[model samples]
Target: MTEHKPGGDLTLGGQRVHERLTREEPDLVARVLARIQAEVADYRRLPVEELAGDIARITQQTVRAFARCLREDRDLNAAELRQIGASAVRRAEEGFPLEAVLAAYHVGTREIFAVGSADAGSADVADLLEVADRTLAFVGTVTGAVTRGYLEELRTKIGQEHTARRTLLSVLADGGPVDAVARSAGIALPARYLVLSVELGPHADEATPGIDADIAIRRKLRRFLAAFEHSCGDGVLASLDGPGGLVLLPLAGRLSAVPEWGSLLGTAGRAAGVDVLAAADTAAPSEVREVAGRTGEVLDVLRWFGRPPGLYRLDDVLVEYQLTRPGEARDRLAAVLAPLDAHPELVETLSTYLELDTNRRRTAARLHVHPNTVDYRLRRVRDLTDIDPLHPAGLPRIIAALAARRASLPR
Candidate 1:
């Protein structure tokens, strides 16, 4: 042990502390390992024999590093810090939380302090203070390095998992071979799958300005879908693409599960403070691209029609969707409704009357008007559009025009 001279510098004090720690290192390491294993639940859960070996090795290495810092009168260099950080990554990979790793460090620090202070018999007060300062500084550096390493490892792991999932989902969405992709993903292909196109309803971002609403909505949807996936024990794969998110949910046995899953997703979206518009179609893995394309069309039609936020299926908007496919057809249909632009109310009456099986009394009741008024609006609609609603041939064209108009309305 180095002799402590009166009025010596901090370096001398550090040397004294280092010598004391060196003599008591074995006992001090044992005490800290015991304290940590007893206090931390994670440590207690680890295999006893293997944990004992790991603790002994780690404690010895850490104590030796601390002793070198004290003797050399310097902080740990980058290499030393990196070593500690590497240990942190390993601990994190072993499923130990940052708190648990930090708690172990704290326990080690306490043990070092207890042993050093006891061995400080009749030492100068200034030397004791210097010892305390150096000890705290050393511990702080180690803790910060370990924290960085732990977080970095976590980020890396998450990024890898995200990339893998995205790749698999992309392949599935592109109609690639299911067996190859599923094997690569290490997940079994479900019997039936539903491809859903999800997006935030119009005006969903009204309250939250200056932020990327689309990204925000996509993130929330991902989280909600993840929870839903866990609840069902089925693999729910999702990816954020061009305008919205695509989710592929696997069903156990029946197409009947679509409504139930859609309902649950609706509830989840509402809870997240966004009105989600989801369009779904069921298909086998090989037909994922087909179903996804159909669902995408459903979403587009819903947007064009300014449909309310909710889950929609192909059957719900088939007519409007089919009619809007051909550009020329849509233009002609728009021309059909052109004459009725001056009589918007007549168009509304015609739509309502057609929806009510052309029943005059029902249409009047729905519009909160008299039956005579309904008759008058129907007459106006026919005169303006040159298509009588009472005529069978004219009624179909009138209905198609109405559908096109609804699909063309701005969202």
Candidate 2:
């Protein structure tokens, strides 16, 4: 067993080329920067004096590293690869286009080839070809490292921003130092926010046997985020956990265009292929803590009554909201429907009747029953509860009782 020295096999011309490249590395690096500034608009827009110095330093380092690799006929060592990666990350942080970065490397390589092979005799053809092959390999390796480093930095940056936004939302909703958190998160606190508690219903694919439920849920979540981002831009903040979570949308004073939330929710639901239900209310920054809880309760009441997919504000569900609160009255009201527990059909008919504005025919149509059957069920409900659902006094009481029962029951 012996040491493998691939570079020992380099032809005379190849060795000369490697030395020239190493000695002229500074000039080669400058040429690379000049080419990039000429060809790439993004690079040209950077502050010329300061950025050019920085680019020249890194480009010289890169050129020397490749020269060493060429001389040894070996690949970049771990430390060299790390240096390349660090430089790439810096460029990404400075908002440099990856295409321009790669173009700079190509320019450097082309310059090296032009000088290295300029006076190559016919006998040096093999070495020149070998160098060309190695240069191509070098490009592949360096570009791969550059891309990986650039994307990783970008992803970390995005994740940090997301975490900061989430933290800001928490402070706003849970009573904390709002100004400090907003400053740290780089968010401007608005005078008011339309706080929302959202509940996303399962998509049809979630229940299908062969489809992956998690994938369906993620797809819906992405659509929801994209829709909200498109409509509200960066002003809308949210924390989504599984089926639902809190959202805060910044208000832009009287002159700001407030989105028609109903239409937006509809578009979100359609895009996500899921049912969207949200409870919303507006509040000043200082009042967000209170409105946040109120919005959550509003959503709870809406869900307890099995409301259809849509947006609901406190005003829309005031009666149900009041009746669902805990008390002896609520318990007694809930008990009014207890007798009909064994007679589910009667309870269903009465609930539907009340829901449809006491319209008998609409209840019959909704329940898929004849009008005669609807009448019979109403009579049975009256006998069982000792309350006629049609009477003005009885209507409100029964509606409250049903709401209380639904609230107390498991969802």
Q: What is candidate 1's CA lDDT for residue 72?
A: 77
> lDDT per residue, candidate 2, 1-411, as tens digits?
645435435454545666887777767777777777787677778787755677777778778887788677789888888888888899889878888887877776677677666677789766767777877888888888888888889899889988898888888889889889988788888888878899988888889999998988888888887887777778788888659788787765431443477777788778888888999888988789999999998998987676888988899998889889988888888998899999989888987898788999999999998999999988888889988887787887777788889877876
**Cα TM-score of candidate 2:** 0.83
TM-score of each predicted structure versus truth: 0.75, 0.83
* Model 2 alpha-carbon drift over 4 Å, by segment: 1-15, 97-125, 253-259, 344-379, 387-397
Instruction: Estimate, for each residue in 48-76, the C-alpha lDDT of model 1 and write its tens digit.
Output: 77567876777777887888887777788
Work out how many backbone clashes candidate 1 has.
0
The per-residue C-alpha lDDT of model 1 at residue 217 equals 57
| Candidate 1 ranges with C-alpha deviation above 4 Å | 1-15, 121-124, 185-189, 202-234, 241-243, 252-256, 304-306, 317-334, 338-384, 387-399, 405-411
**Which candidate gets the maximum lDDT versus the true structure?**
2
